[model samples]
Target: MVGAGALIGLAVEFHALGWSSIPGNSCGGRYRPCPEGTTPTLILAFVFTFAGFTGLTVALAAFRRIRPGKALPGALAAAGVLIALWPGWQAHLWLRGPVLDPAWQASPDRPASVRGVGVWALGDGAGTVVRARTDALIAYDSATGDRGWVLRAPARESVCAMSERPVDGIGLVAFARDEEPCDTVWGVEVSSGRTVWERDFAGRTLLYGGGGVLSADGGVAVALGERSVHGYGLTDGAVRWTAKPTAARAEGGDDAECEPVTASSAGGTTRVVVTCGRYTDFHSAWLLTLDDATGKEPSRRELPVESWVNAAAVLSAEPFTLLVQEKDERGLAAVLAYAEPDDPERRPVTIPLTADEEDLALTGLHPVFTARPVFRAQVADGNLIVAAARPGSDDAERVAAYSLDDGRRRWHADLGTPVVALAPAGPGRVAVLGESQRLWTLTTGEGTRVGEEDGTTVRDIAFKIDDGPQLVRAGDGWVIVNADGDTYAPALAVRP
Candidate 1:
């Protein structure tokens, strides 16, 4: 019975340490861990005490039967040894020193309840991207930080949603916004910051979801949703075509919907990747490639169950179609690039994630304790810049950058907090956000802290963006020193 109790105690310790055979599987049960607010230290102490008491009681019983003198001393010594080591172990678990600098540790001036509004900054000091209110868009000059132009929504129409930052197009910044009765998509000239043209869907179901309006190199913009795809001219906002989503139904079963995950257009081809699942079971995924000129889907390929793409980017370097396959129950996720999306015979080049990144992704139960993988691929100069983190560790998580051209590791920066958001700064740089309400800028070429040394460069964030969370380049160089607190103010936007 003493041996059995020792085995049980060993099992409990192993489980708490996350030493299970299955990676990312904690012993606290998958999909559910120990309930919120359950103190691990208290529970561990209780188990160890109980185990020691039981062993001592057994030894006493044996001593009375066999008349052994040494049993009491041995059991007492064992208990003392365990109690002595408890403090050291607890210190190791709890004493991970602070990740923020004392200089940058000031409290946020903005209220905690404020919601982030849409903000985007342009390249080469192009301009400041701003949305003062939910129904209006404003652009400020990079030199002056003064409003360059403002486009207000009609009284009857409200801006329902926004796309990912300002997409650089042919002499224009293409953005999408869905209104009350219609969805409005526009291409505003960057130089003027005024809408060049606007397209609206009167009362039709607006295409909303991943990559709201993506600019194709061939002067086209595409929007994707679960049930439909819409394309428009980048210059005129003229409707090119609307087509049924390219998701197939499960044979002899109920209808399954295709939810658009991410999309891109490269080499005159627009690929919309969609995940097909019924209810909560995401069973399959595929990609639909359309010709830029006609908006006609030239090809459709159903991905293997093992290669369900979760995120995608059409990299400027080599025009590689980068796909992110998230870690699943079976295996760790991989980032792969293909010369062609439809060619099954063509092999793909895999981009590596930081070790234990899968576990970081699985930590979504608590935002502070978990990290969603950051897989943004952007073309700065001529290389594809990708950002990701290994956040399971508490002391500090590592945020890294890799060049897609040669699969070479460029740089990595150890961050004190789990990553909450990531955005491109400028050439060879990316901005990282943490739930601790802090932001840091790191170089892509070598993950060195780019701004002030000694962590003073890190800036305090007021709160996470509500509805539309976005990060953009700020200041003259690569350092993202500030967020647009004016736009994200509590009075300007309502908390959802």
Candidate 2:
């Protein structure tokens, strides 16, 4: 049964990715055979067929083994017939087609659009928001469901990543390379959808940390790679400075393949932090920080635990940065708070996490569970907000705020379903999206459901404009793309 199920699973994946091609010249080449691409209907049909056949085969085999009589043979034959007819039933539903009502239009004040995954929108009032799609930068009007303006590149160049930065009264849309050996950058105006300036870099695959295209201080735009760091002028995309570390300096005695995890900028300079093993074994972890402006020799410090640091985030406005450390065999997890660069020698505040009955007993008071948690944590308003779900419970999700001053649970919100995205909207407020695809506004003490709509999956990271969260909806919903290159959503405003 396991083997049959595995085969069926592979078939479903192949069909969804559209790996199966049709045979030549059949039914005017219009009716393609086999998997039929990534359309949801075709994928659903294939999954149902596979599941039905697997169950039928298992049932028939089980009956034959148990009885081995004339009735057993007849039962197996009947099962085969039923399995064969299952696809026809599915086809009937498919051919009957989707029931779309023209009367189902979005409210005149709340229009929506379907942007790709991870697209971020910065709100500008009057239903207008600056949004980043997979290949273009667009201005979306949520009220009328219209795209006010769009800036798209030619076919030769692909947009790797985009960041919307508002400087003065103008919105700066920055476009960078999507692939390696990349060197082009373009900035467009949000109001008129016209190109402001374009610059070409001499490097490849520029990494944008923290503050979109410009640094937090608006002095330099920095990009980091495996072995080099480049800083461009924020006003114009001209090269301000470039730093290429030596192979030994970049690797720090560990394997040369391990790249540094870049840190977000603070004050006026951006920092790149790399962890390396002390010896060849990759056991000891060392933290190295480099300045974005000069990229000179880094200040290195050794951590206490000899384990890999999987993820780290910089906590702004606070005196220290929070680091998530995962250690082996010891079965331990630690959150280390390190002081700022000026006081590098100060000992970090280490909060050790362990798995024990006593530890679980400490629940809302002390740290519990040593296993590396799969949730994301950030500091909002002077409080540490962690979004985690209860173990082994699919529907149990909680967002807890821990006071930085005393390490106590200040407030906790039970989000009901699994939280898919969490972003800091402002001080004391967070924008959350659940697995149900519903949007919620969560604060320290309360969570309010803002809206729920079908056919929309929340992006992994959501952006907050002045008004609310910006979302993209597709699949089984109304998609309106006009000749002016506008995609509008009339279905989002529909109440259940």
Candidate 3:
């Protein structure tokens, strides 16, 4: 009975993981072909796993060929070991990392004038691919090339920027009114294209871009106004908390000079970065962390240098890091890391993103001017992983990892070709797609190849693949989204 239950559980797990070697499997009610597998090896593994522990033990005990106590102990140990190691074996031997042959392709269905700036795959099941254009946000079914929904900007208005990511299935967006930069915020549901709520900040306060949110729990929609930070309800857009710098200023310099520029949030804390100095050229900045529920300031830290020519951006809020820019809009200057979050005593360590070696210019970051904070580099595996380009070029040709503790270059892998984008994959690993239509995975710490031997390359595609694409794991496969301001490239492609 124990052996049978274990076998049944293993089968269920394999089915749940989409490892079943069936061609016409019901893949989200769409015609996605089941992934190719090692059928012969799978059969051998199954037979050995079952008979080695269960069948052999039964035969040995029933025929009195061996003692029941010894046979039973050996059988249980073998079964436990096999069950524990099963998942890893399947991940390595059966799945064999990512395959580039897409089950379906979604090309750019817009006019020649329309250009895509970003693409995101939201949700886990079945999944939907969202393409962000200057005009509207379009959702497409990943399994089939059908339109899920369209959330267009108001008449005479256009989409200016979007939130860093969708939170609790709601993606916050910013739109410009006529000639304005970004004056309104809208929360749109990811699965359904319903606008849950909208807030227009025109006459009341100044607006820059999208809402900064921590999580979905008792959610708060936080935004950085001209000089203050406002937290609204995530679902209803109701004002929950608001913190003005003058009222909550620390025992430091003048609070009048501090102007909120950009903000990001993670783990129930919203961090707002404000530049403080004269109007012409700011000298310093302050990073204030506010609780999501109450607008209470928990931790406040001072940044050394910030000016009109040199600016700072909140890169990742979870780990709490900042990117200082050389030019106002473009060029890498340095990266600052907060060793701890919400710890008042913690000081930031400044790390340079661009090295003098000319081999590590970051190409994965959004220009420093956008209202939306969409930083492509990620903090994973105890290091900051960033896509790099050679000096004097903008294409990402290498990936490098720097130590988060002391800001030292640990390792860098020369991809030989430009990379598409970086996406968080399994633990300690980030998925990388080559501009040549191939996919691979690398360990963020050691920068070792954990994917295929030579990586999986997708062939026979009829669309233009750009250098900046997001690699997303949607449902049973992967989705390659092209949003790098390419006017001619396909919006996205789905891997089976």
Candidate 4:
């Protein structure tokens, strides 16, 4: 029986460690069933725990058959061993130590006169690039903190918004100016500090309103006054096409009151989704899809109007366009998947927060979304991971994972900080940046403290550079962008 219990314990440990097998299982019975790859691990854990319990029963039966004096000592010893091993089993299944290498030193000569808004680790994670808001546009080397090149804007209007991503072997920098009648479009080469092309639209008002710069397949799109949306060629910034609004404006209504909320490009097309309202409180929203090649309006769909429509990340290409909208109530987030025009299917999922949860904000850089209380919640891999600090306490934060499909709580762990940033690293792992300047690499079921560095206060952090939770990578290390325009990359204690 003792041997059987030991074997069961070993099996449970293996399964819990992601080694054993189960079948078509959904975690905690939320969402859909688990993927086929997860079945083996689940079965192994169940069998091992059941076997251990059976062995305990058999050992108790043997104790009953023995004399009272001998039976008492034997039972006590078995119970003591079991008690000691149980917590150890849990510890082995969860806790991992901080991992770090001390040989690496911080890089010098970080970019000056800049504030990092976004960080991108490009090409095999060897080259780390950061987009900072300076008097000009600059890309800094993540490893050595060397400034690569700086491209100055045509006119000295503050960079109201900027988006940076690698496109066609060059870092594309898109900026919009709050000032009018000037060139708002600029592209800079990261390898060589040169402006490849610049275009000025005299009458076009590039909305500084929130949303992505509509660019894809080497092209850029911008909404002019309420009447038209224009697409430009990437090579020389030539106008490709201009799309007009589908609905005519009502007379006597103020035209300037209407504005676009978000614009996105995908599948060789650029789309402008706008929310407009009058001062009297009547509001309407529309989704307008434009062809990048011709700049013609292909389809337009009117959507239900909310007080505000927060743009979530783009999901998949087929079936529908998935977006999350936060309602006015605290702690409520809605996921809406809309089919293209002429398709009849719509999937809307409303995810409610825990009763005690509050102050949730989604990270802009990473694919995952986060909500904060004293405890925080992250959405990834079709699951929600919630981390909550204990009541009236601030030392350690406890985390719980739930399957997004079925809303089942999977597992929980304690992380040692108040999380300020939560970004997705890979499938089930998350890179958590804390207000304490500590970085923790965490998975749905596991976590470890990886490294720490001094960080500026929350108020000093700038959101203009797109360098928040979405940009940092836990597998490589925590990249710090200081207030003085210096970007620092420190090696994380945990490896990929």
Candidate 5:
């Protein structure tokens, strides 16, 4: 009886994981195909099912040979009867087709003819904010929404690029201006809106992920390209360090490239982690740590990665770890965390997601999970926030927050939509962006949605993928960007 119960429980768990050997539906939904092949759930399910069948067959044979009775035959007959009628009584409800919300019309008060804007809430005591556009870098007073200063870049270069976004620190903002042949990164003063320094790079500059592009101590800003990682001084914008993956160059051949995942500098050490290889072939990731003062490599650690892992990023730099999101062979979406690049212990902690929860998350949202990997991991209120679905029927999806230190679940919010983004709002509060154009205020302490709002809508099918308004923290309030890369301060009033 115990063994049977265990087998049944295992089956139920595998079903909850949403893994299948059904070819294209390994993630097991009608929405989209997962990039992976077979899943661990399917493997375990086959084991359990085969074991149960063997046990039953042996039991029946023993009973027939030793003490043949009607009991064994009657039991088999009853099981067959139940199995035959099980599907007849079951009912399934198909969901409604997703409807497109109205395209967000920017307010007239917003900057007109805006090509692109990078909004940063310079939350220092001065209550100053910065916005970078194609032609100008404008600073604003957060108190009255008054424009402060505008420093325009030279006409030979553009202020923003289609791929890279600007990032801000205490009183400085860093951005990459795409020139004719190469891109240059400029660090400007937020108060005066003056260019402090500029450094040229071989390719596009790196944008900040969960851990911002700047180091923790604000000494160096890290930029990543297809083949190399360039570190620049935060104050002077001088090239501090340049690292190319030795393993990738040695093993990946001419076609393989080194992709820098994430970087952080603390306690006079700057660590940059990069994954090297061709996605269609085998690859590995390595962590490179250097002395910030001299740009010397003191330690290098090779990270263990699955052959299927195509992308990774640093969640928090204090411990210096990487987060990976990919589908397994059976197509089940998986989120995993690895130790610091220097550590050899590569066992990853798998973040859990349920089939029902995934359904809620993908509803009204684009089904391209593999295209957006960094969105899978977030850090809010010192806790790591992961968008995972729990096993349930009523679409009770949750944004689970785990401890940054121990990976223990700290809190979770049962928002109906999948959490697409998490931004720090205020003390103990987080701004959760649902897959749909909805924003909810979640208190990290209790995992409760204390505030909610219908955010910007999208009418065009093209707008449904990739480009969405980003949520930013301005002092104690919020700032949002729309699909057109225009900044709107009106959404700042969102509060629980």
Candidate 6:
């Protein structure tokens, strides 16, 4: 019985520590591990104590029967005590925090949040980039902090919006005159800062707009206007096409009342969501598909809009996911993931985001579905990849990926501190940057730890970002960007 209890305790402890013959076979239930929580500690302590007492009682019973003594039981108890007091991991470098001064730092008032709007980091290649109102676009050498190039906004006009990602090294930036709409757009070569093409249109967006303003790939650069979808040449900024979206099934007066809210483009596949209703009131929403290169509309599906849904935003385009929001609040209602391009026979999978405050919430970069493109979460390996963390803090506990089709979690790895930024490393791998300034890489296929570089930069440099942050790897060094904050201590730091 004593041995049996000990074996049971061992089994539970091993399982909790992620022991499994298979990668994810009934181990780590729910993937929410409170490694230092009091509950698990208390349970193991009680089991060991009970098992020790049972062994002592057996020894006494044997003593009265024959010749058994307390030697064996006493040695066992002392051994257990020693094991309980032992500290697990040694802290060598963490005890003395290492700090490295930045090679160059941006000013306190570099590109900042304007009129309560969010700031975004773009141009993910071998350079560091930031866009401000006056400095329409700026690129810096990652190691030297030298200004590579800057495109100033036109007089009396501010740079309003930019592309979510650069297409073949070209990025689009829009300028608005005074308080007028961001009508005039320009496609520029990001590396050289040369204007490739310029055009103007009736550029308007949702009333409550946010980041993820534009997305481009292949020959198409998509921008959602007030009621229409506009597609342009990604490299030349030439007008491709413009068309109004028709609902797959009309639920209101007609499709004319509908407004194109969110648009996402990846690998020649583009997705657009349109919401039809009166001012600020919900009626219905439509999920429309288009060829990213040609802007030809193929299929449109009317989403199963519930009363609790305030709006819908596409989290990823490759696998096609719609993030349903709680009505007039910051909570999430459900996540609807559509079928992949290759596998169209699979049914759409709908899963609800956790209402439980104790669990990690799926964090989106921006809440609104306007010209602004969402950059926080992405799709990889038929799953949506994003940072998930418990509420009430800026820190994220893990980076998790869930299958958009079946709603099954593919894998998750513990992020010891808040994840400030992350980007694709190479094929099948992602690089994650934590608030502690640590940088590491993990396999997107299995979520395995590929390698890690214990960061020497100070942890305080990271931001408690409400908006998204970004990590840019340039040459052999890295640039950590905290565009979410306005303060100047460590807004943008380059480490070589």
* Top model number, lDDT: 3
Count of steric clashes across candidates, in order: 1, 5, 0, 24, 6, 7
Clashing pairs in 2: 106-490, 111-142, 160-178, 182-204, 183-201
Error of 3 at 131 (Å): 1.9
* RMSD in angstroms between candidate 3 and the native structure over all alpha carbons: 12.5
Instruction: Estimate, for each residue in 1-496, the C-alpha lDDT of model 5 and write its tens digit.
Output: 2344344445444444334223234233322322121254456557766765565566566667876786665566446435533331231001111122222222322445544444555645336545555566666665555667877767645543211223444233334434332255567655576778876677544332222233424476665544676677776777777766556355545745556655656667767766567656656666678676666777777654555443344555555545544324443233345444455555545543334334222221121111111244455555666556666544334677766446567776666665556666567766666554455667776677663233322122122323334555554444443324333332222221
lDDT score of residue 420 within candidate 5: 52
* After superposition, candidate 4 runs with Cα above 4 Å error: 1-97, 101-114, 170-183, 202-211, 218-227, 246-258, 277-281, 297-300, 308-344, 352-359, 363-380, 383-416, 436-438, 444-471, 482-496
Tens digits of per-residue lDDT for model 4, 267-370: 67665666566444546566667676887776766655455444443333232333445334452253334434423243233333332432223332222111
When summed lDDT is taken over every stretch of 10 residues in candidate 1, the lowest stretch is 364-373
Candidate 4 global CA lDDT score: 0.45
How do all the candidates rank in terms of lDDT, highest first?
3, 6, 5, 1, 4, 2
Q: Which scores greater on TM-score, model 1 or model 6?
A: 6
RMSD of 4: 14.7
lDDT of 3 by residue, 132-233 (tens): 766778887877756779887787776666667778778777666655646677888887889999887631222333323222334777766555667778
TM-score for candidate 5, please give it.
Answer: 0.56
Regions of model 6 farther than 4 Å from truth? 1-101, 110-125, 128-135, 177-180, 208-212, 248-255, 292-294, 307-313, 326-332, 341-346, 355-376, 391-395, 452-467, 484-486, 489-496
Q: List the residue pairs that clash in candidate 6.
A: 211-372, 211-373, 212-372, 212-373, 213-371, 213-372, 213-373
Instruction: Give the whole-model CA lDDT for all candidates, comma-separated.
Output: 0.47, 0.43, 0.62, 0.45, 0.49, 0.58
lDDT of 2 at 14: 41
Candidate 3: the clashing residue pairs are: none
Error of 3 at 108 (Å): 2.9
Using lDDT as the yardstick, the better of models 2 and 5 is: 5
